[model samples]
Target: MAALALRGFGRRCLLARLGPGPALHQTIPMATTAQEEMRRFWERNSRSGRPVSPHVSIYKWSLPMAMSISHRGTGVALSLGVSLFSVAALLLPESFPHYLAQVRALSLGPALLCSAKFLLALPLCYHSWNGVRHLAWDLGKGLRLPQVTQSGLLVLALTLLSSAALAAL
Candidate 1:
């Protein structure tokens, strides 16, 4: 039944295009297949002489924009880390403490251990602080340009301080 209706609709469109006076003024909705839509898209873009993608490298980077991208990057990195850890936990024959023992057995220097801790904590701290900033945005606060820049700076400072503190431990 739906196919029949569509067929009838196509006939009406054909007749409308071929039919008499005032037909041009009266509009008929034309259904498009994906292929036709894509063909038209490429044709229009080619005629426009614009690049398919925007020239992101040419644009000046701003603090808020950098923070926004970093926020997403940290989120992805954190998620993947947790997922891999979970999978390792499930798949490894021995438990996490066994791995911890092995790592400790290396008798790594204090500075190296602290650096590793800092590296692990850095993303966590950044993501957490930025998350709070996003929550503030959701609450309709610190949305102004100056406020955004201030919040970004605050997030960076807090992330460094907290990560350093964690690394010290």
Candidate 2:
């Protein structure tokens, strides 16, 4: 009786290992099919002689276009500046004044130092004012072409004015 029960258990285990019914471990060749399809697509597109999309080199420069790009760039710069300042605040052994003192001790020329400070402040000011302008547009203000041009000019003027003020300090 014991031998018979052992044999039955062994058969059941073998069947379980074989998996339910005849749907055994199947190898799908979908990857090769996808590659072939992609190859065909490229071939078709190539044969049709349709021009590919133009890259950035194709676009002409305009004031509005330049301002739009600068807005994005300044935003990224400000975010990175804040992140670096936060990291320095946490990692530096001494307080903020200590670092300032050390920098002062370097005796860097005032003009050069002020220029660097101006460069940093300029982007921040530009991005901030432009961001406000963007928000105003979002609220359905200044959407007209004339208003856009005027607001863009305002953003530039404010950026330069504020940057100069900060540098003077």
Q: Of the candidates shown, which would achieve the greatest lDDT relative to the real structure? A: 1
- The number of residue pairs in model 1 that clash at the backbone is 0
User: Which residue segments of model 2 deviate by more than 4 Å?
Assistant: 1-51
Candidate lDDT scores, in order, read: 0.94, 0.89
**Which of the numbered candidates is closest to the native, going by highest TM-score?**
1
lDDT for each residue of candidate 1 in 37-115, tens digit (9 for 90 to 100)? 9999999999998677675545678998889999999999999999999999999999888999999999999999999
Tens digit of per-residue lDDT, candidate 2, span 108-157 = 99999999899989998898899899999999999988998899899999
Residue 17 Cα positional deviation in candidate 1, in Å, after optimal superposition: 25
Point out the worst 10-residue segment of candidate 1 by lDDT.
50-59
